[model samples]
Target: MASTQQSRILRVGLLQDGRILEERHLRRPGDLTVGRDAKSTLVLPLSEDLPARFTVFEYRANQYNLVFSAGMKGRVHLGSSDVDFEALRADGMAMQRGHQYVLPLQESARGLVELDGDLSLFFQFVPPPPAAEKPQLPPDLRGGLWRTMDRVFFGILAASLLLHFSGAAIIIASEPPPEPELSLDELPDRFARVLIPPKPEEPKPRAAETAQAAAATEEKPQSNDAQDKPAEATRPANAQEAAARRAEVVKKVEGKGLLKILGSSGSGGGGAFADVLGGSTGGGEIAAALAGAGGVGIATEASVGATGPRGGGTGNVAGIGELGTSGAGKVDLGSSKKEVEVSGRVTSSTPEVESSDVDREALARYVKVRLKAIQNCYEKELKRNPSLKGKVMVRFSILPSGRTGDIEIEENTLGNDAVGSCIRTVIRSWVFPFKPDDEVPVAYPFVFSPAG
Candidate 1:
């Protein structure tokens, strides 16, 4: 191998959520799944109060796999709990054991491996637990001892079941909420009326004056029954008929939640602002929506173009601006006058490290494994035979530490170390997906057949 380093090492790793990853290259996957093996350094919990399933398979003992989600290509600021599984690759500062990485829910989350130098790729997921003896109960227990234990266990289980169902029933039988009790006794002024004295009135001026007075003293209702009586005299009324008329008025404000906010007297900016919230499943009333906005007080069209802070037209604006062939084209949204800046970055879709806190049954993780790339070495062996066609099979173990353990020729239509070594290099360079385990990290065999 010409370019093979003697005592040098390269490492990569990946960590994904609770999911299984199996040894899969462009070859034999067998019973395990071929997970998304991109290189990402940071891994996070599924949620605050849950275990995260992760895999960390390795192609070599020193390296790891990295997996990244979409659009995580910037200065990732994971404050405290953000999981940096491959903190071993920390570049800038020394990683103390007590430090924490908190990942706030971002618009687009990223999985990145921060190493001394940037890596071209990384993946997530590691192997399952290594084989271990299963714990079992002793077989020598006799008669009453076992029977008593069984009975006690059954009793406790039954009690728990009964309690669960009883609680559910109690919740189901809860009564509906009582209706809001209405009382006219302490009702607010908005729902009340007053009386006023009769006065000589002119048709043109008095009619305007009536509305003006109502609009003026509208803020605080007319508490004077005398003043209220005069205002009432101007209105057409009869005792029974007036009661009916009030009912009609009440009906006018029904169905719609119309709130009228009346401001104070002369030049007090008194006005009625109605809030009519529309039910979903239909178009909304623009006027109602506008009323909700402080855009209530009307500005006459004459002053419309003169009062803008931008020294432009007074019409309201929201999203985009003028579509023109480039004159005073678009609104110079504050930042437009500044120089336009361009940005660039590099991202690997591989998984880097996974959280070991929650071990999943079927997820996988990886370790760094370097494949011996013997460039052009295969040409010598193949040229000697001249009949070396088709693929040669190679079998190897993708160590839990992400290194290539065992390597042997599985099949060879025309075998050579050059042929087998090529497959070995690929298997070593590539990552086999695996799940994370809390007890013991498992080891699995990885197989590959090189392209002819």
Candidate 2:
């Protein structure tokens, strides 16, 4: 009973006459010792004649028990012990230690415990009030929720500011870019535009005046110089002489083996031959006449009479080849003549070793390999500016000694000069097949492209 009583709460009240004088809510019932001592639950005045430690009250099942020690000095009275109060007021009581006093019959009442003379302490009994049912928040939890809301609000604000700044920076950086400047090599179109002048507009002529001028020119009399002269006409005697002179010219022409007549013109002819053999004749006219007459040789026989020391006739004209003209001094015009050999000189301007004579696959392979080494230049330039992509046409000459020279940048779409120069330097260091006859010119194209 004592162990169970020590765990429950006890409410003690001290009252005098009717009203409460003092109240205490006790958590530890075992530690409650009322006395004149300073550490007791209810310390009385030293002159009260109470024990150094007085009585204690313990709680059980919603009721309180007053327990007194054997050494208690005061006489603690029970409910309405010496009072003739009303029946309702005769409720609470007090007792000596080592003796248990049940509470008063009434729900609330007081007892007078006499000390000395008229001085006494009154004890009261009262039940604890019902606990309230309203819900409440702890201080720690409320403060934590407020702190969390504050952090979330600040985080959202910071995020919004960062996004706003980022978008602004993007807009600022995205302004229209500057237009590209023209390169030095791009001046050809400008030069052509400036240099080529527009054709002059001609003045329109009056149609009536142009027609009158044409009619006047047509009405003018034509001159006939050939009919005005009689000496220009050919006669039989002059025709014979003209034939002899034409024969001499044919002999010299045949001697060079350049032209050959197919057939003989009749030596005694008198019509077209008469005109051909007449005085007025030119090299072009004679050729035309001979071609028309079928006089060019084709297996016809003729004899060439050579003048020996005795001046004797070597052969008759009829026995000579057809190429030999029938004349007093007959010569063999069909005989083969030796052409002079002019060594060490190229008569034609064309290269002795043309592109067809070169091994194109081998040359292409070599160039492909060299292109890899030279690519470093454009690679570095493209690294700096990836937009660079174009063609480069390099024209270079391979000397007869197999060394590359006369390197030229025929076309370069790349804006940088260093790229072309670097490529030229690499090409100059290249060696090719030795050609003693002619220098080989190589035209190579390079295309540069950057990867995405």
Candidate 3:
């Protein structure tokens, strides 16, 4: 399981529990030196030791090419007697920083090996056990051409590296002062306020008050004249009303009990009736009433005419006297049509919405189920690393109908990728309880991080 660039020592029990963790293999350079901080020589329990001495080369895609010596053959380094490595792993907990890798068994053989970390090579996977059958190749591709390029290619590579190193040294020596470090303290304060002029105070309003006072003074004289004119008009209105009342009294005396009136003639409901109010009399009734009458009253009009010889005295004394005599007059009657009026009342109504339309209890139950589903995933990570702490904010889609939709990364948020990756992988596998409408995905950004 271990190799060197020059030689290899295939040790048994390199990965005793079928796992090699890089974190478990890390050690301070000082810790590697003997005797200063050494632990007591206590035998380890049923656990393989981490590699005490090793050289690590990182390869792409989560692979490592490790090499180490077999000087302590058949004896592996002791695990930290203080810790339980198995429980930490089983719970998905991270080991300590100094604990990177584990080696279960070591082989004593020292030779050149091209062993793979994976199935085939570094950045590749190796089989758990060797293949029993040998592989065959086609005859045409089995030529010696692949072997010839190794030496020439390596020689050219070495020469180019040497030239590059010489050029880099020359550039470094020629430079003078080091560039200034980037700091916010060195930059100007962009948020500083700029200078501005003070605003002028508003003017007082004495002039407007003076103008209003002068206008009020001018209106006083005009109001006095208007009052004096109304006093003069009151006397004439009193005289005209008295004359009309006398005529109304005479008419009431003549028509008292002979005719009944519909309404009073005065404005306050007590004056005599002004219009003719009796119905037409029948001929037979009027004749019978006249038979009892001893005398009948008759009216007559006489015509006066003057002949030329009859010595007509100048009866027309003046032009003004004849004008006052009676003459035929034209008259007008008004407003014959009746007026029509419309009337109705107004009322209001409300919309058909109600609060009980949505089922609140069902919604609350669904929310609880979702929260529990998410909490279960967090417990898995905590069990693995009790010391692990972080908050991860993930922006993923929940469909309008409540199904899981797109899963995406929410950038610029708190999270540990080691923990986040596992959580995300497991959450995408869950099934939701409801179907969403419109299939429109809504993003929920959930966060998890260290409590501190």
What is the model-wide C-alpha lDDT for candidate 3? 0.39
TM-score of each: 0.14, 0.22, 0.17
Model 3: residues with Cα > 4 Å off, grouped in runs:
1-367, 370-373, 383-387, 400-402, 411-414, 430-434, 445-452
lDDT (tens digit, per residue) of candidate 1 on 150-246: 7778889999999999999998999878988878767666566433335667757668788888887875565566668888686766688765675
Badly placed stretches (over 4 Å) of model 1 are 1-380, 429-452
Q: What is the C-alpha lDDT of each candidate?
A: 0.39, 0.57, 0.39
Error of 3 at 282 (Å): 99
lDDT of 1 at 352: 19
In the range 360-396, model 3's lDDT, one tens digit per residue, is: 4553444445654555455555555444444444445
Supply candidate 3's per-residue lDDT for 90. 43
RMSD to the true structure for each prediction, in A, is: 49.7, 30.8, 34.6
